[model samples]
Target: EFARAPGTSDYAHNTFVDFGGVTAKNVRLTANSNWGGMFNQYGLSEVRFFSIPVFAREPSPDSGTTDVDVDVTLSFRAGREAAKHDVYLSTDEQAVIDGTADVTTVTEASHGPLPLDLGTTYYWKINEVNEVETTTTWQGDIWNFTTHEYFVVDDFEDYNDYPPDEIWSTWIDGYGILTNGATVGYPAPDWNQDEHYVETAIVHGGEQAMPFFYDNTGSAAYSEGERTFAVPQDWTKHGIKALTLYFHGDPNNAAEQMYVKLNGSKVTYDGDAANLTQTAWQPWNIDLVGFTGVNLSNVTELSIGLERIGAAGGKGVVYFDDIRLYPLFSAVVGTFSIHPWTGDGDSGISSSKTYTHTGKFTGEGTDGEPFFAGNGVYFERDTNRSGTSWTLTGAANVFGTTNPVTVADDSAALARSFFYGDEDNNHPVLTLMGLLPNTEYVTTFYTVGFGGAGLRFVDITPGDNLGYPTRVDQNGVGSGSGQLIKHTYTATSTEMSFMFDALKTGDSWHHYAFSNEAVSPNLGSN
Candidate 1:
């Protein structure tokens, strides 16, 4: 049933009608009477209906997204007639759905960059509200997102050159103490009061890094920079397993054992000794489980220090940044190397190299079996080249400098044989399996060139981080020994890989043996 207007016109005109607050699913219309001017009884064309919009739609992060930042703003499209929005967020899904969850009513369509915890899934919803409308509330659908597992303990980004905010002011170093060898910042050339002390050029992830200088040349045995928390920090949250920090060293830095102290418990570095000399930024992931005698839940202090490894003390500058806490990653957090070795047979061992070899004589010497006398990590011979290139399947032994070297038994079998391939068609790849993600490893490779074969260049590229394409040059004058090349990388996946490309046409590549070892925060096994 409906009402009709009395007036009539040549063109079609719209009619207005009020239902006075009625709720129905269907509506019908019929002709009560016809105007006198019309030829027939009555006529009807079409009819349409409209109402106020209810629910909030279109979530910003959508839903079920993982690895979201802890400080993420929840936004959505508000209902058409909604004058205000009620935001509800929580870790419990049932709470958000029941309307009893924590609610924040706002005029805007967006909620927050909410205060959230790491490694957690949060459920959220919005209830659109308009008090004047007959239907005052419209409940929204439940949405959820997960935050990242890791949290930043310190990035050094908050520190500045100003007073109180200065990096050295917070990170107390041995600048004024004689017993400690650490000087946190650089000395300004002029008496400029507002001089920048933190290292700006060589940084790990941010605009600045702490330039901790160590001078153990005098009476000091070690250098350290410590920071005391204003309030006790609880490291036992978010299922955290490791504490990771990035350190960049100068080439002139003295080789010292880097260590971090939790509260007062010390955990010395287990990586290569030469890492302090390499100019690249290296990650030192310390396992929290290893910090014995410290209350992880109530962490009060943290210290980064370098201790003297030998009788003689050395000194240099090392930059530190991005000290963070990390949980075990399901799918590798960073890149890592698989191979590890003991001795450096070559020189110029970068932070990448765990060990290098300098010998020239090959597995076979001038005679049938010459004396193989050198302290090195030896690999078992792989009779088949194809199998060895794909998988290093042989027993490896690490020999210290003090260990006695045998002539025929040890040196003759020292892994000098490798897969020979054409540069254009075939390239060798070495793969190491069963590696742990978020762990750091050191890989070493032994390569040698034939006599008078000119300077052969080969591109050594790791599958993941540490760096890509480390170029190795082999001078083929006549040395029987091979050069040891090593690389350091964190494992981003369960497997580690390497690709060898011989840049020269005629020159070939030979690998006798290799080794792998986990350095920082060693879990005993990979």
Candidate 2:
């Protein structure tokens, strides 16, 4: 119940009450009495409702903005009745009142010099508060923003070509068979334009979107759109690991085949390829960790092609807009190895393998749970306490970020050897349950703890196993990378085990033990 004098004696005009942080879908004001009358008839001047701070302004990242700097300050306008403001920031969209308001400032409000995760989305809101009002808090609507890497592949805002008229492969849906090119420019209209016309256009909050056509009618086996783009920067040096974009598909059109080409190598979609949903405009993200072999740096050209393989009538059209590239986060890391071999008829045959995996390593202790891998290999923590795993901390070197792969330079640049000990005792362990009996197998791992300041590879888990003296082949530098310790051997029995125990011995440890982790297990054809 907000109260006021009800009516003004000065021209009877300035009578109002301020409600700080309250909102409703519908508001009904029931007046009891005023200065003009006792109960029935009352004089009221004006009423106003606000879902947000009445005068909120100057959002740091800006509403619906992208490519925001990692270290950004968030600020907003001062409320009309606000004595102070409660500000909140979060990566989670549905978060509510977690007690973690980034900052609450007087007069308008500002928070930061705050650090942000790279390649991530953030949601923030402001709530106005008044010390003297009956209601001191009025929460506002949530506003969102996203942050990107220092490097930007393309925003699609400025293309020297103006409109990519010649880029779309229009001949496919009989689009090329006709004449005036396939893909066309979509410039969003301001007013209520013709909905039936395909060109009234829906842009991704931009001036234009390049849309392609697909007929799949007569002689139209497939309806797809393809266009090539010349990458502007050397994203490889910038640690690019993910690709993102905005897409639009007609609700009337069903699932279709969608594929993308990076430097000519076909990289399949993470989702179902046969069912590319063409609904409202949405963002799609693709992680590059699983991409076996793709050169991200010095990337000259990229081609995007979509085919309507399962459309009911054989043809349909789709729209794609706003493509972006990103670096990895601190939580995601990849460590891998390359094996080039020659023998058996193909002497020059060479191939490489990567050991980077995306999975959670919780501290479960020795009595924790265990699960089997796709290869029927059962694995568990080195001990019962979840504390046995490697520690995540700032590095002694400058290559990585507090030992985070996704936030570091690249997979190879990670320094994984930060530990709490110099002793050879306590270490993280993992056992592989399914290995062939007496089978020849070679395993290579970039073990960090073993070769610390003065520690030997033998100091850690060398010839490590469930039980028994296993065959110890060799331990040495891999590629120009002297840090990667390659250990090979033959399986004496079925179950194989490994461990990370640099800190257990209580031996003198430094910032150098255990840089990062990369493992490779190869069972030669027997």
Candidate 3:
């Protein structure tokens, strides 16, 4: 006899059978269950028979493999009423183990008593059986996992102090207004002195006030000096990469000049000294690489001279600030290319150009167009054309607008001919007169509405028989509705000529040219 019924539980629907009614000799019972019902109910029925078979337990994995060390552990329970079972573990493939063992066992449902090897993969399984000596064959799924080395970083730190090491100071004197007293020289007193130089905030001639020493004897008499601090021998031994000098100049006097010497070697002011003024403290960084001729490895001293190169009558003063020496470190300098004829024959213009390229610029309108125009020339990037090019459009008309355009008061203007443009007929043109002959040059144009624009060269020479006889034509249509057309001509002679034939005009085309270089008496000047 056999009976089937559902287990008395709400959480699970399990089927069980009662065989107590079977009263037969040598009786045996067998049961089978399967999933059933919408909610996963189960069915089970019992069968009574004689001669139940006995079986041996599956071999357990060696205990050594069962409790291996691992970076992390994982485990899971077989079922709510499931009894403790033996778990077996083995390596990937039945590969022969060389001194390394391959078997392991887990007594219960706990994971890892992992293997001892790091980053080794292994397979595992569990076997279920009855308390009696009867058991079923290995009936568990196989799983594999690998171990990995892991670590954590703790307590990391970095530190930096600006203007590292060697220190120097600047001071202004002869104002009779010395805060520390009547110091003899501008920036008077060496680093050991009681007083050092300070920059004046007042600006002169649109420039900063500078460090100065004055002598109001009513005669051309004034003396100013700058002192450098002592540097360690090891500093030069390791190589000094840079020197920062802080100084102030009379903003009103552009002709003032100052000389610097490090360890008695003249320090070239790579930039304009006349342009230095005392509006705020200024840092002048000098690259010591150029002074290769000087043995900086043994450098021990530094000095500066306040010489008045302007009208000797101007009794202006200069100021100085923080002076320092910085050790050389790996420094990356950005690279840029500039045409030779881009600036005046003075170093100031070149320095200004370099600064403009490397410094951040901000103005009104998108795409670098300045809202107002006062002194600055706008630099524009041309996207409609190929090749690395730029254009500078003048701000004349832009300045004439109801909302006049204005650049910063302290800024200087750099005008060029090649200005970037869109489909609109709004590009700029160059306005120079004579250009060097047969030389390749880049021309930048500036206009009021447009901004910075540039043009590269194939060849440049004097225009036809006209004063400026050579002409180069740039032809292309902008991405917009209009075309970009222009002809640049260079004058061969000093006389200026505006030949109407030299001008090309059309609804979709236009041309103009000019030379800005002075005609040189020497033919070799070209």
Candidate 4:
């Protein structure tokens, strides 16, 4: 029990106490006596408790922010009782939470204009330190942010002639191996009149580059440099879409097929083979989709190689540098329905094959059977189709966020099964959310009608009066029930709206499906 001074009054004003610091599950306060010497006569008005001010709060890039610059400095407001700060940072979230991250104690409240890796998320924390206080350390809350997605795969700047750091240490070339004619780096005597193992003179955006010599002759018809990753990398993360590499030709090099392989899945460069003999640096950008059949999320190996296209034997050296991965751009392409999708549940009208959905069905012959396409698309049903009401559905995986699709509809149905708009103005408006801004997308809509005459007509618009609405009537083609209607539009923000207005009264909008795809950027050649 603790006591105050003899002159301290208990009932005159609010009481204050300094407990220094505490770690407890329960705290109790007992009043022994009042100032008037009667404990039962006095009753408490209010009681409060306060914690220690030991948190370093308000971080700069704010927590969980995206698109932060790669060269960013982290800063935080110091705690009220802190004399110094211990900053911990790492790419691993568990390491930071366990206090095992790279740490530095500093008098300042900031940590670095750091040269962090691109397209990566970093976790950090600041522990307020005060050696003189009763509580010497106060653990901080973990904060994280993602950097801009544009990181280098390799730049050849770290290669050296020393043991285990040589250019050939990580990059396996065809030196002693048979049936391959690739040689990496120069010998110690100085093939290029230089002491370094890397080519410093023919570098691209760096101090050095790999001198990849290829000799495709006799039984050895190809030359390649291969590297196996110690840890498999996920190319699909952070919205990565393309891989780019810079190569400088020697003008005397052999004319061969240039290609790259990811986990043994090869993608040949589509540019002219003569670019290998141009004596200038050229960029080759390959869409990740071109490396088909490879698990892009778990790529374990990479290879850059050249194969002789003709009977003529040739040999020369080429310089490569600055291999990098890039994120998505503002471009979209074609659209199609996920296959095995038909009426009666085999491949019938469904919104998505990948995303999960919840729905209620009434009188039907398998009207809302689920389908799986393995592609990153989702579908949802708007059960309230009687009045003009908008409803949102959840989507995962593709957008990396919740609430990706919304639908607004008005229609009438038979036995709460077959649906059609009685009024001319009643229709459905689809809103796609979490899309890349300024990106163009082509969307396909499937309209199925149960009417035998197939007399349903509707006008579909891609956006709000962006252009003339495409007028279409049900063709009753697919299994004698439906046809597809398509539209293309550019998203101005994270959200875009599409309208499907009934062009004729008594027209059916019975079952519906929607699909969208982004246009593929120029791959392999650019």
Model 2 scores what on Cα lDDT?
0.43
Q: Per-residue lDDT tens digits of candidate 2, residues 1-526?
A: 3455534456543434555555546766786655545456664465665465454556666789997877788877666778877777787766735546455555546777766766678888887778787667777767888876534444444532323332232212224454222334333323355332123244553554546554544454444343444434455543566676655565344454555656556665544432233333444456655445666654645555554454333444566666776565221111112222111121111123222111122222343344221222223322222223323221112121233221112222222332233334444443444456554444433222233222222222323322111111111222122232333445555544444433224432222212111223454321
Quote the lDDT for 155 in model 4: 92
Model 4: lDDT to the true structure = 0.63
Best by TM-score: 1
Worst 10 residues of 2 by lDDT: 341-350
Model 3 spans with C-alpha error above 4 angstroms? 1-197, 200-210, 214-222, 228-233, 246-249, 268-273, 277-300, 308-314, 319-322, 326-388, 391-526
Which segments of candidate 1 are over 4 A away from where they belong? 1-49, 57-115, 119-123, 126-139, 142-150, 160-162, 190-195, 237-241, 327-526
Candidate 2 TM-score over all chains jointly = 0.31
- lDDT (Cα) of model 3: 0.33
Candidate with more favorable, higher TM-score: 1 or 2: 1
User: Cα RMSDs of all predictions?
Assistant: 13.7, 22.9, 22.9, 19.5
lDDT of each: 0.65, 0.43, 0.33, 0.63
lDDT per residue, candidate 3, 341-396, as tens digits? 21233112221221111111222235433322122322332222211122223212
RMSD of 3: 22.9
Per-residue CA lDDT of candidate 4, range 1-526, in tens? Answer: 2333345456444466666566554777776776666346545555577875578999988999998987798999998899999999999999999999999998988988887766779999999999998778889999999998676789988888788999888889998877899988875636456568788766555578898989988667899999898999988765678887877776567789989999998999776777686544456768898898999889999999998898876788888988888774212221112121233333222333221122322233343343222222223333443111222222100111122111111111111232334455566555665556566655555544344432444445545333223334454343234344444455567655555555456553443444454443321110
What TM-score does candidate 4 reach? 0.40
- True-structure Cα RMSD, model 4: 19.5
Query: Residue 472's C-alpha lDDT in candidate 3?
Result: 19
Clash counts per candidate, in order, are 29, 39, 80, 10
